[model samples]
Target: MVRSRLYKVTRGTLRLLSRPVRRAQGRGGIVLEPYRGYGSCDEIFLIGRVFRQSRPAPDADRDSLRDLWRDVGRRIARRAVRGAAVTARFGGTEQRVATDRDGYFRIHLKPRAMPDCADPWRAVGLTLDAEPPVEARAEVYVPPAHARFAVVSDIDDTVMHTGVANKLVMLWRLFVEDAESRTAFPGVATLYRALHDGADGEQNPMLYVSRAPWGLYDVLSEFFARHAIPAGPVLFLREWGLSWTHPLPRRAEDHKRILIGNMLALYRDLPFVLIGDSGQHDPEVYAEVVAAHPGRVRAVYIRNVSADAARIAEIERIAAGVTAAGASFVLAPDSVAMAEHAAGLGLIAHDAVATVRAEREAAPPEPATGPLPGVLRPTEVPPTVVIEPEGGRRL
Candidate 1:
């Protein structure tokens, strides 16, 4: 009993004295890293990071923010940062974890053993100790028992057309556009929202999983909010194979498979609807997911970014595989078709089909330039230097 009391006292003292989130009065800039998290009715998993803060040097006054080298210089200057105070609060329970040396942190919290939430989505508050106070929040998606399915989607070339198959074009568009300037594919917003708000208006959980790196978190998050897509966790991956000598980045198919597998593990009872574009290996990757998880996936929606016949045939075969595993799959060129299929499955409302068509007609069309010739699409070959819509220039 005496030792327990001492331990409690020490913990309280450390919590009071440490100011991990505070920086030296504008000298160090703080960034609260945000990522998507999943949870059941009993517990939630939250992962985020707290940067040590990157500030310009005294000599950086001469450099312009728009300078070509500015982003590189900033990256060289920043550090992963350790010991930062990060917090996640929800359901009357607040959990805290400190940033590791790599500036990453994870929170596994049970807000309550049995507390009930009215909506499937919950915003957990995160804060950094600043003079004016710096705060960020992450949304934790919890599907209700009656909810039919969850949605997992990819961003580039699927919902938002970036011409990702072509490196030069993808980079030019990514660097030039801000979140508002970046475009979403027509009708995607309506379809996604319908999936989020199901047939009876029960907000089913959704997650956006991308082969894009974690760096694009800020821009991608903004795009989702601006587009009015069903808000959930934005899941991303980091590229491997960057050494002192080998400078080129490498993306692996297994990274996607692993993340999706983890999601399946978390919600064993919940079925998912996988959505991605054919411009990349989404069909193959998601097919592997269906094979691995069996019936955990309720549906697979492959957006026909590449109209090539062979690619179409491959997707159809994958769809067949998914159906064999007891889930429906769709290879749709437009959002309305996918919406129609979703409605047929009782995943969304029947009227959502018209809403998707209207949204598509109302939205501006993408630039005339399609993917450049000779560069491989996601189905034929993996990209050597693919980047997301935001947060990165080179892969």
Candidate 2:
């Protein structure tokens, strides 16, 4: 209770201090910034923001310290336009929306009949109601009916080498590093691509969920493109609160659980391959998901990043419940093991295993970041023993 009061006071003070500076700045015409949206055939969900001025693009060659700092400043110096009127047009339907105080608008459109197209992404035309009306195009991904199974993966530790357990290190990676400097886990790009391009030559749906705030959306998008990881339809990210005491997300478990549940409901017929790491509460949250929606999950792949004996033991217990609920729970030390298991299940091509292994072996070593205790590198740990619900088995 005391901490809550302190947080409120601190946030209010910061808002008061910034208001005059924000007002002093000159405002420009309305600009619509739309994020990638996704949904099934029956319904579509999309979200975007309205800003007074267009977003500033960073330098193409963002290598120097000056360029890096300038890029960060441009990305973070946002001026949102409140109560802006906008219209969304798609499927011969038009809907009007008003931006909230934060300049964010959400559209839920249930088209009478979706336009027939082979492409997974359908464009939604957006128009801002202003003196000189501004127009932009946004896209929503509707998985084709032929898509076999969908993949839902976490972004932080599962896909990349983010020191999420250490707040200072995580902040450094998130704010200071540019997209080109950020690194993905070895073989992650190949593994995700294989998952996207399934065994039977089908294009499966890939969705990413992260606890990172929406402020880092552009950086994350660039990172995925640079790494050649199959792009997800939507990036489920949380809003960063202004309180200094609670800079990071407070309830990571509930945030992830709700988003995963929403995805399950969106793709009613499609089963999912859930992927995350053991560094945080992923195992516990995924256990609840498996228990809540049995038979909907095909497999759960947890990258083993924690070296604590107690943490591994707890994860093993969670894996037991997950397997009992009828999904394969794989605690893998490296991406190669995950690829091999996926190939055996026919989730991906058997030949993709060799590709992943080769990439893992050829990838450059991680940059030195001094001594980080309690965090185990993949090369430092032996293969994790897979514990079956009824009986344990070695991977």
Candidate 3:
């Protein structure tokens, strides 16, 4: 009877201790679950938990428990959260939402067809609610035009291609891949070089706007140096904040637009070039730029990376608008084509303008093309060799 009582006490004590762990598991599960959020928009939250066996002594298993907890924490802190897939539809197509720990994600919606007017934006959020229940739903609303573009650019598949790989996969490749393993599109360097070189007092200074995070600055710099490409002042969007436990609320495109607007305000009269790839929101962003700064944009050049029909149509519309404005809108299959188009615009030329120094210090004129005057010519042909032949005997 005494032994049986002891057994009950032990059982109660074990349950009491296990309760905290269980609660932590439940709360921690939700803490790290990935979800989507908007800065000034609706916030989507996800929750997650860590699971483990409850047989070992709590103190004895402290190390293992701590390690497991840490592992899970690291995963969550690193923004690795598994949840329902969410896709945003804009420009008649869909784009996926990328998630990170703290149950936060930045959903990139297709920009409204008419950014100037309020149009309904749409997105489908999918979630699996097991430990952290997965939920799926569609979100539709118009986002405020928080900023305007002075410039926008394409990221992957435009600047660099780890080929057929996703952004996360490409990031891994960047770390593991060899120097030669990476590739830059043809003429990209030259295009950037021309822009960096600026427009000979007629063109505005260049701004490099891309979706690549600032962390890749060193790697990108190395890439440029390796290719002998000219470097320009780069403006990168910080992916997330150090204090951010969740994904930052700003969309990559939105971030770029914000930056563009800031630049425009600083140099109100300066024009800008919108360089981007077809793989993403370049068309939409460039279109927005055209709309915002009708005459301020110099050109929009899109590097074709995908063959999406809808994207193509959007590009056509953007091109037409650009053409109407006397500016250029080009869609090229590769960087070579982009270069050729730029060259056609007289943006890139071979003729060097004669500078003041060159004109002032040109070599002295070459000897006269025609015969010189008698006074100027040597006096060798004396006055008709008057019988100077054999001397002797005065004639």
Error of 1 at 115 (Å): 4.6
Q: Is candidate 2 or candidate 3 better by TM-score?
A: 2
* lDDT tens digits, residue span 38-140, model 2: 8788888889887763333334333333443343343345566788888998888788999997789998888878999989889999888877777889988
Weakest 10 consecutive residues, lDDT, candidate 2?
17-26
Deviation in angstroms for 241 in model 3? 5.4
Superposed Cα deviation of residue 39, candidate 2 (Å) = 1.4
Most TM-score-accurate candidate: 2
Badly placed stretches (over 4 Å) of model 1 are 1-27, 54-76, 83-101, 112-116, 123-137, 239-254, 369-395
Runs off by more than 4 Å, candidate 2: 1-29, 54-77, 241-253, 369-379, 387-391
**Candidate 2, TM-score vs. the true structure?**
0.84
Backbone clashes, each candidate: 1, 0, 16
RMSD of each: 13.8, 7.8, 25.8
Candidate 1, poorest ten consecutive residues by summed lDDT: 383-392
Residue 57 displacement (Å), model 3? 37
